[model samples]
Structure formats: structure tokens, C-alpha cells
Target: MSETNDSLAEEKELLKSVENAPASKKISTYAKLSGPGWLQGAITLGGGSLGGSLYLGIIGGTELLWLQPLMMIFGILMLSVIGYVTLSTGKKPFQAINEHINPVLGWGWLIAAMLANLVWAMPQFSL
Candidate 1:
């Protein structure tokens, strides 16, 4: 009975500590927890996004201010779907796409990603 009481006291203390933690600390903790996914997201935001944003701003000015956020929401949704599919199927994204979707679409996506990487790298290489 004493050991049970002690274990209960320890559990309550742990819960209290978690409850008292600052909101910002909790957010930062979660960010650290998702470090690998965050890094992948950062890497995904490359020259293609920069170029797209530049063109959108140039062509539409403030009139298209909603476009960027809307696109980001859509991108996030698509990424979530991909993540879910990969997790549920235990398959790589490309393999899942090729096997479950269309093989041509998967190959085309791979080629497009490769071409975009080369295009973004060209100016850096020249410099």
C-alpha cells in the first residue's frame, strides 16, 4: 500500500510538471520532436518556391495576396496524404505512387523533380 501510494504520488508530480510547462516550451519541444520532418520541409522550400512566389507577386501584385497561403494549405494537405499513404502501406512514396497510382505519373514526377533541381542549380554552378 505504501509503494502504491508512492507510485501514485510520482505520477501526479509528473503530470503536474507537464501541465505547468510553458506554451512556447511545449511548441519548441514539439518542433524538436519533429526535427527530421521539419528539416525535410525546409529542404522542400527551395528555388522553385522562391521563383513561383516572385512570379506571382510580379504578375498579380497585392491582388493575389491570398494565393500563397492557399497554395501552402493545399501543399500541406497533399503532403499529409502522401505521409499517410506511406505510413499505412509501409512503402516509399515513389513506390506507392507507382504501384497504387499510375507508373507513368510517378516517373513523370521523378523526372520533373530532377529537372527542377538541375534548373535551380544552374545559376549557382555558373557563379
Candidate 2:
């Protein structure tokens, strides 16, 4: 749709403008411009909601319906715990994970996030 493309273009521009300032600024800019995308990605990307939903929704209608929401709740809880740990300790997530958890896990998380963003976002540019 024209509207979708227009919005995506605007958001791409906005994100580009804030790309290098700082992590906080980039997050604030995204929250300002595309709150829904941020929320959707935060919650659903925990288990590949978009693609999985499209495929799963096709075959699994009412059977085992409680599982998806259950997973989402657990995902949210996990993210909250991670946030609490990072904030209470006053260390960046990457730094905390590297120090407290495994450094390789921290790097893997970072790369996966970057790749996920790139995977979905690159299509908007072609539009």
C-alpha cells in the first residue's frame, strides 16, 4: 500500500538521522516514530511470530491455542528479568552478558538482533 510504503520510508529516514548519536537516542527516535513496530518486534520476535504465525495459523486453528500466548508471556518475563539485571547492575546489556554470562553468547545475541533488523528492514528500502 502507498501508506505503508510512505510510513516505512519516513521511518527509514528517521532512523538514518539518529543512527549514530547513541543507543538511547536511537531508541527514543524509534519510539517516537514507530511505536507499534517497536512493540511488535519486542514481543513477537522472541519466537519468529510473523513468519511462524502465518504458517502455523494456516493449519493450527483452535488446537493447542494456549501455547502461543503462554510463550509470549514467558518471553516478556524473560526480557523484563534481563532488563532488571542490566539496570540494577548499571551495566550495558552487552557488557553485562559478556562479563556475567558468556562473551560468545553476548556477541551471538548482538549479531542475531542486527541480522533480524536487517532481514525485515531491507525490504522497505526497495519499496
Candidate 1 lDDT trough over 10 residues, lowest sum: 118-127
Candidate 1: list runs displaced more than 4 Å.
1-21, 46-52, 115-127
For candidate 1, lDDT tens digit of each residue in 64-97?
9899899779868867877887766769988998
- For candidate 2, give the lDDT: 0.72
Off by over 4 Å in 2: 1-54, 115-127
What is the TM-score of candidate 2? 0.44
Report the error of model 2 at residue 83, Å: 0.7
Report how far off residue 70 is in candidate 1 (Å): 3.0
Candidate whose lDDT is highest:
1
| Residue 103 error, candidate 2, Å | 1.5
